[model samples]
Target: MTTATTDLAASRFALARQVADAVLFEGYVLYPYRASAAKNRMRWQFGVLVPPAWGPDHGEPSCQRTELVMEPRGGAEVAVELRFLHACRRTVEEARADGTFADVAALHLPDRVLVPWDEGTEERVEMSIPVAELEAGEVCLPFTRPAREETEPVPGTDGRTVGRLVRRTERVDGVVRLRADPLDLPYRALKLTAVVENTGDWTPPPEGAGREAALARSLVAAHLLLGLSAGSFLSMTDPPEWARAVVGSCTNRHTWPVLAGEDGRADVVLSSPIILEDHPRIAPESAGAMYDATEIDEILALRTAALTEEEKREARGTDARAAAVVDLADTMPPEIMERLHGAVRALREITEPGAQPVQGRDGPGLPGEEALFRPDTPWWDPEHTDPAAPHGDRVLVGGTPVGPGSRVVLRPGLRRTDAQDLFLQGRTALVEAVLRDVDGGVHLAVTVDGDPGADIRRAQGRFLYFQPDELAPLEEA
Candidate 1:
């Protein structure tokens, strides 16, 4: 990907592909690697949308969603069988926990063999849940599995090779259905959770690898969401920073904000604390919304596309401005121009030029321009076309070109009198000193012929350093 590509989008896409691959395997939680020939493979579908802030250079944004399908192995499976058998001998509790299982069993047997398993089948069961008794927060959904691994027998082991014996049994499948919201209150927000099955047939992640992967995925999704926000929100100031701060403040109940710029382009900013507390937009006055990993990824992808487009549009303006500055500098008077050129050349020797300003030459002498003109050099016929001379972001003087990389100083108020008009004609001089700007732009410390250490300085006290665009060919338009 190009440097312009957002890091979040890249991560989201990567994880989405992994999840898609994982769900396609059979026996999702129990034996992911083992496929029951009769079971159907998992499939995913996703889409993307662009946010309002990101411009055309990025791309269109959209969302993508994937649906998971689980199929059982053949043999008319009517029940979910969770079998735990001890293949090795161990202490009472250690033997009871099977280490044969992958992630589920690994927890108990940090070093030894241990296993735990959960089986979910499409079976029906009766429950005595009262219709009216179910309050809003009364009933909670909880799913728990073994925290450690359980031990199992090796293929041909008469006894066992790894750990001790463990107890195992079958777990009946439970299906939950809601008759109605007992409180009869509408849900204030949306909630989403992911269900991942660890099939033991395949190799499990190393110890806590699974948890690490999950966390990593969440971070990636969050980033994508931010990217989506950038596409939708357009701000005059630090758009990226504002977008980040806004998203960081989002909660479970808040909706994303839409940002529009003066350019008529729009991007989305994630709801922030400022937006939630200070603004009247988005219902509930809180960010209390939850999204699944996939949902987050898709939203972020869309935002990324929008931001990319916005950036491309922005870069175009920058390039144009650089070109314009070069043009304007070319139109200055000869006397003023020489000083500007000389002073800048001196500056370049000390610091890197900010932007390249092209240089141009009028005739050797325009009418009434004798004070700044020289019959000997003939401004138009000036012989200084050596590539060795500092070309872009550099200056040419006395037949030698000076680069911005060297240190130089300007004599205050055109102190030097090579041609006193060079400074008198509203032109600045180059002297030895350090220049700094806080808001933006480049800074430099130059070396001049006179002052050993010049501290206090201003724009008028020095010559403006030029970049590549600040100078042009001696005569070429």
Candidate 2:
């Protein structure tokens, strides 16, 4: 019964849930916040749970089962909590003068179609059929729609069709049941979610409290699905009133207490954020947000290349406090200013153009110095094989054809490890050699144009090795 450990576990679960929530809305930073955008169409792209009915080629299934498993360490008392979106559906009917019914293809629900539970003027309720009921094959649920009619015609549809909202039901086509009673630790993990069918039909809900109903309505209309369940140990004391209230208010989040025994170990597993048509699969542990590492690296590199000189300067300034101190030092203290001047003078003297030291070689008395330094075979010599010359085989470099002496721009991306010289990105270089390594992989050796010194005697040489994608060929000079 370690309270501190249980509390820590609860906090971690809460934070993880928050991270998942952020992932859910990652694509909202677009011009139109709807899912029609090519970018936004990838719904539930992460945390996907695939059911058995759907294959890779067949695509996602409409209905599936999802489950979570929790194992408490020792004999600890544990509570489990869950949250997710519920699916609701409503039928739209067109009024006919002949008292005949015709299907309306263009009618869309602007808001959630409410259902009334009793006839005594009670508030309308949602179609919230329990999983147990669904598993029992009880498909029909009571649902009612408001007596509202579309004032304006739905865009892109025939104007002749006037539609009226009639009745609605909880969509059970996608997900049917979330089975947990059969599980060993049924109390710790269990949830039911249904697949949403019309993802493009509903609008996203606004953020903040008092919008659960709206959110639920939107999710059902969109065919978005989620489920949650919670269980607590009978021995453990009840949670605080405030905590219980918060849990009740937040439909998408839940909290539960865990009782730890002598061994003090409690493990809780939950379904992934998205459940596909297949059975729900547990998601792997993630480092905060889910994103492609390679994509991130490429983006970082591009952003760095796109930085303006002024922006680079600002970035190099470290922080405001340090920048302020340096700015103040410019006018204060004559001694400090004198030291700075001395430092600049010394730097200038050392970095002067001709200040490079020369190295002397021993025994350079070859019979013909020019002939010894020059290529033994001419460029036109058919029998000659010059390593410096481009190979007959064509190779792509950064999506462009490249050969020896081809001017190329390095695109080392944001990872310093990806580049031999971190400063080479966006800088022009020459293709000195294209060679095959021991593994038979093609490598491009390019010498950076503005590099201070030639890499003649260095082991790796002045030619930095790069993959074809890392260097873009420049246009003919």
Candidate 3:
């Protein structure tokens, strides 16, 4: 008979809310329950709820149940690992072909497609996926296998009576709302729920006490990740008018910067392709509307009043670890930040060929613009290395460079192959010098012993770094 509403003022619930908000992002709250399942399995049932914001945009959360057997560790902690695969029913083509209709067939790929959305379109999509899939960054479907057996059944008096049946269940459901024209530029809000159960001795956390405790822990984790107050978790506390206005204005903008308004905080419309790619299990609709920052602040204050000094220390330590991985962009090294920015740029460069790369101070990059590549840095050179080396160059583009004496003049309209040749050879061609062309085809400042175009182009782009000795492979290209 107990519900989450029973102990809103309890410090445990407050802390749980903060932690959930932080780790799960705004507009989502984790709900945990103590329940018994089919057999002798110990589990905790928990989920992220999107509230009314997800109602029309997505839909009511669909309930599901899955059983997973775990190796018995202890009463306090248990390890139950689940892997999910192509779980989502819808695909990128389906979502983009018509934001309003489920036209595209389902697709299961390592990475989610970048769904484009247009302005003035309201997108609501709800789908059920495993919680493990959400954490793994792909649409993970359940495998057609039953729970694994850990320990054999207890022997009966007759050596083997009917084996005792025990079932452990784990299920996760997610919902998402992608607003605006998803075919053009889509912004999605997501929510997820994970339920675990032991058919045997399943002891639910104390209603008010348990829910409060779990929620507080989740929020603290989120806070550690965002570096923002738990109050900043909610994006809807501000007037709906503001959100609508911001969404409308940002619909056409290419890089929709996370913005702050009269709400006294910053928020980005949930249109990030990264989230969909990283959190495949989360439905686009599950991402909730902005919540009241004040609500989060108030919750923190209440939690502060309730926690013991010892509990606070323990909570802080747990939060630090969770934040390290969950807080995207906020917690990354300079090198990683650069690679992330570069990948984004590469995607943009490929999709929007005409879009000019930002330059000097005007470029859009990580906070300090430190991640942006400078035009003078020679497009042929690896962004991380010096530009002068041609023979010992480790740049892995797939084209070759002409010798220094050989004239290699490049202008607009050259074949992509020719351009790639210069790049692969680690030489500069007098390629188009337009703003967008900074990273495009270029001349190779050819040296006497540069490799051929085929060789150079073959060594252009790779995931791993190559050593100077590896440059000889370009000769075969």
Candidate 4:
């Protein structure tokens, strides 16, 4: 390849790694960052592949599979990388006068605090194969991580070993299998399947085992980063009309495949355990990783900064990554901190006075310009003109027009991820307004009827939001 082509590929690979790194450590550590935190104890909940013996009995998966549509050029090949964390148990011990050492959860040295914790060692298995090879037959690549243990001695003021830190890792083995099938669609394309299984030999944890036991013999944060040496891969989430049916036919087990790297480029796909939009990018303003991807960076930064000196010391002793997060929070510059508070991606100035009003999804919006967006009012203003006028909008629920003040029965759908939504089922609610997300999806803001606290909730302009389809219109109300 030419130098420019190689440089572009290198750049794209780096970009893909940026997003994949976020997924890799999404829940690696929580806000407090201290090992003593309760939430920190129940960790490794995402993208975990346990031993086959420890199946869904404990709600853990033993395999991850991703299927994608690839318009392969003749003789095109693909490179696959399975990235995950290898959990290593670290134990802190203190030496006694009798030459015996006892395990201590925390041991304080003169310069730093030391804590025993399960630290993750980043592990990856990568392989490349020709399209002909995968099309002809399944190609299996088996990998293994051997068991090992290491010790680091802590010196006392007199330079003698006062304590020791022991790290132990178990043997981990897995396999990645790849296969391709040619499609007979209008265009030349091939369906590719990649499967990752924890083939490690191990006895399953007893029934009702906590996540920690199974995680010891599992592949934590297991995800695949796929690259096409030639040809583009079709997005599983948003495919063209012609490939919609094909995309639907593709099956993904315990993984969500989305285009990665450069925007609108399909050369790389990140098959993440957590669902992600295509071309996911880390915020340029992000100072460092806190591991809780759902929370805003500014909030996390503030919370980290609020940690007491002792708490921060414990967090620093928890893991190397946690130390980095604590350091970043304590020293973040004011300018960078402000940038994390808010970011504007787009701005439009009203240039014409005679422009028509913006047309909303439900009906016409307040008119003053060609676009409904007003320069004077914030985009979220309830009384202002906007593309999606929530208060003025009505959604059809079971052929019944439901809008503000309309009564409906809540029936939370599969789209609701929270378990609390179960209580909302069959509950009658008054639709406060119709809210639209940036993706153009409509949501119904509602207040539960007959609830004593609902009135106060309404007064505060706070209402529970649900998808329009998760509601049923009441006939009489």
Candidate 5:
């Protein structure tokens, strides 16, 4: 590739890396960010490619498959970059009187406390092939990280070695097999499949070897960054009608591929272990990586800052990245912190046909701007009609004023908003917010009480909406 062309590709990958990095460290550490925290005990949870033997028995997978469709022009080339984390075991040892070091769970120094932890090192495998070559023959990228150990001395105030940190990484072996075949379509589209398998020879110690034992042999946060040197990739999540069936024909196992990089340009695809929409980008409000995708940045930052000083210190000693997250949260600029609080991206117009108008101080919105409220809210009130100012709105549910925080049993009307509402038939939920529709309809945004994922749903702002009339309030105990 020419230098300029190579530079352009490098720039594209750089933009793509921001998102992939987020995925890489997700769940690497959780809230509180302390080693002693229960949540941090079980690590390497995301996209873990374990030994094939331990996978079936332990409910983990040994491989992740990513399949995507692309339109390749003549002489178009595709380059695949496999990125993942190789688990490393870090042990904190204290210096003995006789010049030797002994492994200790925690080495307490004047400033910080060091603890034993398993960390991940970034690894990648890259290869490129012409689309024709990929279609004709399969390509393999066999990757290996050799076992190695390193030690860094932790010096005291006087510069003497009070303790040392020893990090050992096991030999991790994996392979990525790439192949492509033409889809029988009117257009020139190719279906590409990339399978990543853990070919590590490490044997499972025993049935009770625990997850860590297998994690050492696994590929953590394994994902792919696929680039089309020429043509563009199609969106599997929202494909055009012509290629809808073709997307269905593409089989993806334990992986979700979505168009990435610049918006509207499908030259890059991020094959993630978790679900994501097309052209997904990081929220601009995020201050930094908190290593938890399910929770809001503001909440995590606030929670991290709220950690006790002792707790924070312990968290800082867990990993350098974890320490940075804590420090960012603790010392984040006021403006940045405020931005994380929230923002209204855009208003969807609920002023469609049969929709009602919402009153505003300036006598309802302009006909020009009124059409922006239809997508999300059934009612169009950006602070006037629907959600903007409905939080305080109360409706009588079983003769009780039901507003935010009111408990109610859902009785979704026969005209169901969603088929899944059937499962929530009589479940009790807490009203999170009250919203009004342009049609004068009221929606009670609620979360099911006792639901295992209730907190996560709340954190994700994913609550089920129901009309107030469909709810029967329960008195607070």
Candidate 6:
């Protein structure tokens, strides 16, 4: 078995954390990008590993285990950093007059409840224990009845029966413990498990709104994503013999299917060691701060028109840094430069209100200009005009210009280390569409000629996306 030095493994761990952070806050970039947005409030939707028996009545405790294979370089010691959601089972209860508990009940009262007359009079009552309060463990809260005579209860709770004027405590006393085994390099796999449990004595919330009920009994496991550190020498192409064996048997290089058997247990297995080449180790405290900068850039792009002069100045400063990085790194790939240039241009447009829109070489705009022009729309939408060609006229395949409906062949050497490289070298494909990514990079969407997988091709509309360098135009015989 191959081994990685402690430093190399640490760097890889940092990169994994970055990828996990990206997955964690992906939806934050959508419209109404505020924490208060209703859509934004629904968190931890990605990479959720719910138990098969996870439901209101069953509420059976489940554990999510992620196994990663790593080897230290030169017999050096390595430590892995893992991050994920820590899910805890929380109960939302409403105190009833009979000392019974109802999940999220409401209270109703007259517009003007004469203290003496309405004391015992039954009225519809509704109340909610804030999620934050519940996470903090036992606490009392006052339920103030709105001065309205409404016959209806709260939207998702049971309010038909009048409940007692008792306050309900919302507390997060549950703790999810994570345990990891050291990288016994002699063995090929390292395992980590997140065990979910409830701490305090509390009954599960009664099934009400589907969403509310899920939150009530669900155990939220935090930082469930796995991060591994391996030596710099190991790469996707030149992996150790053991790592290669593990990846060779798997369908995906980066993400694998973690199925929960009837026993309600699942395992996410990763064997492809992430190669960190000359990458710096980021301090754990600064990990989130780094992501915060990227988030700010996204927010600035969305509200470019509304930025004030001071904000515009700051945006320009960021543009300057990006430009300087691009300039200093002349050998940097075109994709990197294009991304930096896009940032600069985006900021320039905001700083210079009357500036003309940047045009592509061919004409006023490149093909599929709508995607580039309207950054607010869903960039990944298939219906959007292709950013690479407006009229679907021509696309560059392997640096050679080819028109739509043309034949192309996948070129080798461009396989992504993070995802499955579906297109094999020398495989034939049909040029179906040309699209531009958010970074202003051009991508060719092609359909494989002999692929018979209906689930991937028809059901998922799975098209092999390739950079111009990854595809070559088919030549006539």
Taken over the whole model, the C-alpha lDDT of each candidate is 0.24, 0.34, 0.24, 0.81, 0.80, 0.37
Model 5, 204-253: lDDT tens per residue?
76546788878887899999888887888998866888998989888899
* Top candidate, metric lDDT: 4
Comparison by lDDT, 4 against 6, better one? 4
Off by over 4 Å in 1: 1-217, 224-385, 388-477
TM-score (C-alpha) between model 2 and the true structure? 0.25
Clashes of each: 116, 18, 86, 2, 12, 43
TM-score of each: 0.18, 0.25, 0.18, 0.75, 0.76, 0.36
Model 1 residue 82 distance off true place after TM-score fit, in angstroms: 37
Candidate 2 lDDT tens digits, 1-477: 111223534553453444334434332222121112344333233322222222232353222233222222233332223233332223345557785545553333222211111000112122333334433442432222232222222222344544543333222122222222322232432222222121222233344222222222322212121222223222112223323332233222112222222111223233233322122211222212212222332233334435454433332222222223223423345543333332111011111133342122222222221101112343346765543543544455434567677888887733224334577768998787676432223567777786666466234555677766566777886
Q: Assess candidate 1 and give its lDDT.
A: 0.24
- Per-residue lDDT for 358 in model 5? 44
lDDT over C-alpha atoms for residue 451 of model 6: 76
Q: Candidate 5 at residue 137, lDDT?
A: 81
Q: RMSD for each model, in Å, please? A: 25.9, 23.6, 26.2, 8.3, 10.5, 18.2
- Give one digit per residue, the lDDT tens place, for model 1 in 1-477: 111323443342233322222222112211011112122122111111122222123442212111111111221111111111111112212322445432222323221222222221121111222223222223322222222334434221344343333433222111122221211113221111111121111222454233212211110111111122122323312234424343343332212222211123332122221121111121121111211222332232233234333232322222222222223333435554334222211211122234333222322222221111111221233473321222233333223343444433233222223453344232223422323221112232332323334334343354344322222222212
Candidate number that wins on TM-score, 5 or 6: 5
